[model samples]
Target chain A: MIGRLNHVAIAVPDLDEGIRLYRDVLGAHVSEPQDEPDHGVRVVFVELPNTKIELLYPLGENSPIRSFLEKNTAGGIHHVCYEVEDILAARDRLIAQGARILGTGEPKNGAHGKPVLFLHPKDFNGTLVELEQI
Target chain B: MIGRLNHVAIAVPDLDEGIRLYRDVLGAHVSEPQDEPDHGVRVVFVELPNTKIELLYPLGENSPIRSFLEKNTAGGIHHVCYEVEDILAARDRLIAQGARILGTGEPKNGAHGKPVLFLHPKDFNGTLVELEQI
Candidate 1:
């Protein structure tokens, strides 16, 4: 049911600064950033050899990214995304097993246009879990 | 500078229950558990084809895992560790760049006896980052 790791989600205070650090300093290459209006965040994808790094910044007060930044406890790791063979089926299984789904029923296009969904951290312990279907 | 993902660490209250869920239900294979008295926790490793899952339970009050579970906030993900070429060099680079180190300067034996060190989450943001040298 699980594929290779697709990407690692990271929450940062400043998208530009994060991009600079990951790209210029860390030597990671990123694709042009895209914004998700519905999710209320602008994100960039720093594609790595085996996995990708996603940098997220809030676009509005209602955005969860904003809340995440406000907490500002650590700007480090946000979520681990496992590539899945079937996202819809996986989401259903998780829901049936009592995992709370964060987004609407539909999976939306994420940083790289891949369909993605988030499992509520409350349900999965403290770690925010994201599932991306390849 | 890195190998395939080694394992993902998770903190849970009941080591037995967590083991059952990941092993019996998730169909992951696990190695016999070992106890780390110094770290104050007992741990089990569930080995997957592409990755490994670590289940940690506190053995003493001083264990960080114990405090993590006491929060009872979630029964989910803990930290994401990336395989690295040189953990010592990586540690020094992160330190020089202002990242805090969690363990003593020496690399300790982790679940599989691999050398590993944790970068303070406060320094890297909220994410608990671990680097394991292959």
Candidate 2:
């Protein structure tokens, strides 16, 4: 089962602009940009009191975010992450309930250096749901 | 400034089905369905330990969720809501920083009976951002 709301990710065309918007304008504490090659994204975290905002930009032409941006042009909310106490348990429970997991159906290292898995958007009402181990 | 993440809203084609998925399958506590005529949608809240998930369905032909579902038949994430300590101050700050407020540029009563304002998706990397006064 989901534990807590981890973070909401937003895909942006430009990482610096997104950082500036959240930092200077929104007064959020933003971390240095980091390249998540495995995920094929350049990301930065905007820290909030109770949660964080992840700014994601495509790292390559084949990156999924690139295709999302191609259709949206302006980028958009990529996914919502929820924390779980146990990754395998959560995955099994979801699978038994007939939820499809993305990417080999195994947990991968997420931005926070924790195990994470993405659920099919169709199963989650059109929104991609990310489950991360706490 | 944003205080905390209040909830994530997902637009669903069927409200009852969505409730079943979260409540029966995911084992979440779900609130009774409520018709929010002002927002032109019927909604239910899935209670989580840290935050809530709002399932939205079109209430009428002109409802915005109707168009969203037309594009994404399976439904999807609608918007992200963040709590603000002061709605007016947050609006003024965001507006001053070039973020366009949606609707009438004034706070309106939101689902939880709190003042809320929406920021343009274009300004926040295409993610519709909702600010609610807590």
Candidate 3:
């Protein structure tokens, strides 16, 4: 089921550079970037009504974003996240319907400190998608 | 500047099947799908605030969506389209900032019959983005 458009995730090679680009060009206010050591990512948020623009940069060598960058020739968009009312319910429904879960069983804190889960790209047609519950 | 998120474009193998899945599961209202012969696409829009979820299916062999589908092994998300007040101004700015334009020079009618242009993925990093003017 389609829910609210959560946040659009953009993978950038350099977090600070990307932040400056968006802020200066788009006049978007950049939130403090958070480093998620567990996820191997550093993210900054530009909040909007019912949505956000998430700037993601790899935090470590093993970061999945790094691999995505390597394989993906362009990096303007990484994923489209949808916000669901219930994370667990959404996850179960998606999995039952042939979607593959990429993250662990539990929902992890995302950039906005909301519970989040990522679906495998293979499961979503070709797009890497994330689901978030505030 | 980034106007509003006009719509999120998702490339699907089958438009009818995708519409059913989104409507039945997500409770989204499916708008009358439009066929753009020039673009070789049939698109159905599910509207929301400042955004729409666009389900795109190829209309012919030369369809760019078809090539995207072929190159992309997965089938989930495609590109994120942002709304801009002035398509021409935005296009010029992006080009001045080293971003490449993908579509024809002139703005063409998009799914919603709005003026639209596509920026090369190389400009923003790796995300394929579309800009629409309402």
Task: Give the clashing residue pairs of candidate 1, or none.
Answer: A74-B125, A74-B126, A75-B125, A75-B126, A76-B125, A76-B126, A77-B127, A125-B74, A125-B75, A125-B76
Give the TM-score of candidate 1 (chain A).
0.82
TM-score, per-candidate, Cα-based:
0.79, 0.93, 0.86
Model 1, native contacts kept: 0.28
CAPRI category for model 1: acceptable
In terms of lDDT, the poorest run of 10 residues in model 2 chain B is B20-29
RMSD of 1: 3.2
Off by over 4 Å in 1: A20-33, B1-5, B20-33, B46-49
Clashes of each: 10, 4, 20
Best by DockQ: 2
Judge candidate 1 at residue B118 and give its lDDT: 80
Q: State which candidate has the highest lDDT.
A: 2
- Predicted candidate 3 versus true structure: per-residue lDDT over B70-110, tens digit per residue: 87544556787777789898878777776677857678887
- Comparing candidate 1 with candidate 3, which one achieves the higher DockQ? 3
Per-residue lDDT, model 1, residue B73, is 46
Task: Score candidate 2 by TM-score against the native.
Answer: 0.93
- Candidate 2 lDDT over A1-134, as tens digits, reads 67677888888998889998888877778999999888889999888777788999999767878888888788888898988899999899999989899989989998789999999988888888899999
- Per-residue lDDT of model 1, residues B1-134, tens digit only: 43445667888777777776555533357677779887787889866546666878888778877666766545556677777788888777766666677868678886557888886765554667677888
Encode model 1's per-residue lDDT on A17-124: one tens digit a residue: 777656653445777778887778788987655666688878777877776676664475677777777888987877666668885867878655789888776555
